[model samples]
Target: MDRFIWSNRGIEAGETKLFSQVGVRIYDGDQKTSYDDGNINL
Candidate 1:
């Protein structure tokens, strides 16, 4: 079990962006995925 928090501040399209993400993960085999609680596509 794990927990995380992230934040990114930068310029985007001539504007400032503050993208944040929060996630939790548990591993027990037979399962795999990506955490995207915020701007993961950015």
Candidate 2:
């Protein structure tokens, strides 16, 4: 699962990208978030 939560300016500056991993965390100069999937066995 790849996701980017940024403003339009970010996209305009080529900030769009994809990420793959069993479990990972993301931060966009704000609150810290994590990617959790109990079904994944990684």
Candidate 3:
């Protein structure tokens, strides 16, 4: 179980890095609109 948790965290971190590298914007629930810089919003 501990290994599984660590692997999951690693996957999440990798995904976040990939997203940032590709200019993906991940906003909170309350922030539904894109910013003025025009990056991809999700």
Top model number, TM-score: 2
lDDT of 2 by residue, 13-41 (tens): 54444543454455546766453341221
TM-score of 2: 0.26
Better of 2 and 3 by lDDT: 2
Tell me the tens digit of each residue's lDDT in model 1 across 1-42. 244334464545765535634464433365654633334412
The C-alpha stretches of model 2 lying farther than 4 A from their native spots are: 1-19, 34-42
- On lDDT, the candidate that comes out on top is 1
Weakest lDDT window of 10 consecutive positions for candidate 1:
33-42
lDDT of 3 by residue, 1-42 (tens): 121121212344335443423344444466643433333311
> Could you tell me which 10 consecutive residues in candidate 2 have the lowest summed lDDT?
33-42
Where model 3 places Cα greater than 4 Å from the true spot, the runs are: 1-21, 32-42
Q: Which runs in model 1 stand beyond 4 Å of their true positions?
A: 1-11, 24-42
- Each prediction's total of clashing residue pairs, residues at least 3 apart in sequence or on different chains, is 0, 0, 0
TM-score, per-candidate, Cα-based: 0.17, 0.26, 0.21
What C-alpha lDDT values do all the predictions have?
0.44, 0.41, 0.34
Clashing pairs in 1: none
Better of 2 and 3 by TM-score: 2
